[model samples]
Target: MKLLMFIKELTMLIKSLRGLCLCLESGSGDKLSNCTKQHIQKLLKANMMGPYGSEWAVEEKVKRREMVAPQARYIFVYWNANEMMDNAFTPLLGFLHFRFTLEEEIPVLYLYELQLDSSVQGKGLGKFLMQLVELIAQENRMGAVVLTVQKSNSLAMKFYISKLRYVVSSISPSRVDPLVGVEKNYEILCKTFDHEAKAILEVYSVQYRTARRVGFMAAFSDLKFED
Candidate 1:
């Protein structure tokens, strides 16, 4: 429970920092768009907007979507060290998943990657993190959580459906959801945020970790804008 408490604090911190940073950068500066825009602009500032676009361009789009993702409003979750866990705690990419928030009033979690430090696999830590997602979403009043899985990955599919009670709903275009994985799916599941979602995601740590590593993130929501 100590770890859970730390997670809650961290989530609050992430929300605050992201909101603050956006406030500072929102609606200001010259209009640059798309990841490719910034790239081409360095070569020639004018045509780049119509053509290759810039790094800020792509980032802007991804940022906007975080709030207006057609079918869902998303919030990312991450974790960091806590009272119980020591600084030596193992982490993968400082967090997990690069999915989206379903664009809905109630919201749904669409998890992408499940990258864990190889040291923790098969130990149910993934399940724990997932449950953590559910808990955070519920805490934030989300409806359900959804994720896509590879059709070939029976092992993973089984883990989710059997262990987590997720059911296969639909397969994608024989290709993976760009954010999810190699398999095709639109499988959905529901967890009782009030019941099982007792934990919170450490979004603060998640955001900091992301910012520290990538220096650019449009993950939680899309950051695109029009000129």
Candidate 2:
């Protein structure tokens, strides 16, 4: 309810200011009066709120969404309606959600909200995002980059597995989709980062499952080593 009020307030404020600006520009006063300037400032504040509020909303949402954690930075293909130096963004589809975040010891490039407008699907932007993911992962000293693909999406599954060296880490094996009346299996892909971390997240996952759960949680609670 509060958010709704804020949106309404901002919308009304923007509408009023735009009208005021048009009125002033047409009048004898070629320069903005104090009141007009203040009104313009309010418009500016509303414009600025959009960006900051979007960020805060994302931060708040990340808490509830099933997402990899510690995503402190978010870079985009289209940050604003305008990027630096007035360079018009490439027309290949917008915001691939090709965003990633480096977790404590791993980095995962999530396919956030990918859509190529059905026109640019065949283009190589998807490949470019994967390549960027690998570069960023290595730079961050993270283990392996992980991602998931649906069994029905055979083409995408193949793209990750064959091109990016991602291997299937887990499978649902039983999600026979009700609509399709066919089987649906989710494949979890993990490209063994440098071979060792790959072995750890995989081997550790398996070993941890069989592991005694009694005192294990406490042992990893802190990694600090002290005699």
Candidate 3:
């Protein structure tokens, strides 16, 4: 049953990519050769510099090597809106860098990065990439999909929370200790695929679960209800 769902997800991703005029090439482990690594680094650097600044990505040159690590997986999305002419190339649209890892001892997919060009932003490409990420997570039997977002990046927050239905992870540093940790200016968010993952990662605190519950309660504190 799971196998069937997995196959279906793969098929769905393929169809969706074609429909979007994009191509998906996924590779695992050492398949990410030096040339591939260079390509990814270049794309990431270009996409990240605007949001994070040049100083922040100085480390990315070194960190990008993780994509080639054992068990790591890379999904590169390419733009095929224009056909290659006389050996010309189609540009890269975006990519997903993720890997299987243990979260609370349960298998999960940790999304290192999901990047799309500015030209494609808000055109449903980001959501399409995330859909493939979720499908890949489920197909791999992962319990959840996890990623980090900068607090200053409200656009990303809204995209993940309101659009993708992800929530701030209970295990996030800020959630665990909001005082000092909040100064970190980032959040760890996740979307679980199973009950166990939900239990582990989802925040069930009254304040977090409810929509502005504390504010509502305070505003209506003087109201009395007749039983």
Candidate 4:
């Protein structure tokens, strides 16, 4: 996607904020500077390590690889310098890593990460960013906005489900087969835009025994994107 197009639309949406001054920039992961990449890595680890726990060692490696993959696209958020109380305060507020990809033969926007600085949490920025993503998905003709959330991260779960109204995808382990879902640690969530998307992503009716083997393997396969 073109950065100019994103900035133009984002400028209009950001006007809804009461008093915050923000700037949005877009780039591919390979184009980010080392300093910026390090900051993102640190922020991601800080927000996710706890939920990942023993799986972090392996997950971190996967995340690191995914972070700089050529397909990875980023939207970097910065506090407008003029809005800062202290000139020395870091302008980098947060970032969203995502990709325009295919899921189950449907084009979709897959959100890989959304990390915000603690100082900015509870503000409306996170929701605003998600709204922006949904708009982008629509503009790109995507069927839905999909993401993976750790079930253990209650706050994240609440934010996506309760606040954003994203539902557990039909292919998610829990819905496909609760017995097999017990072995998984995360849920795939989605907000579909069309009837086809809703049907594919929000409806499920498979036998438990059959789902235990087929659904379990399909749901957990590396063929799908991860958080």
Per residue, candidate 4 scores C-alpha lDDT tens digits across 113-183 of 99998877887889889999998898888999999999899999999999999999987899878999989
Instruction: Report the C-alpha lDDT of model 2 over 126-153, residue by residue, as the tens digit.
Output: 5654655555555555566666565656
lDDT of 1 by residue, 101-154 (tens): 543233555664344434345655556556656665555566556565544456
Q: Count the backbone clashes (under 3 Å) in each candidate.
A: 35, 0, 0, 0
TM-score of each: 0.39, 0.46, 0.77, 0.84
Compare the candidates by TM-score and give the number of the best one.
4
Query: Pairing residues by index, what is the TM-score of model 4?
Result: 0.84
Instruction: Estimate the overall C-alpha local distance difference test score of candidate 3.
Output: 0.77
Task: Name the 10 consecutive residues with the lowest summed lDDT in model 1.
Answer: 20-29
Clashing pairs in 3: none
lDDT of 3 by residue, 83-123 (tens): 44444443666778888899766688999888776656777
Q: Which ten residues in a row have the lowest lDDT in candidate 2?
A: 19-28
Each candidate: RMSD: 17.7, 17.6, 10.9, 7.1
In angstroms, how far off is 142's CA in candidate 4?
0.3
- What overall lDDT, based on C-alpha atoms, would model 2 receive against the true structure? 0.44
Worst 10 residues of 3 by lDDT: 81-90
Q: What's the best-to-worst order under lDDT?
A: 4, 3, 2, 1
Superposed by TM-score, candidate 1 places the C-alpha of residue 82 at a distance from the truth, in angstroms, of 11
Which pairs clash inside model 2? none
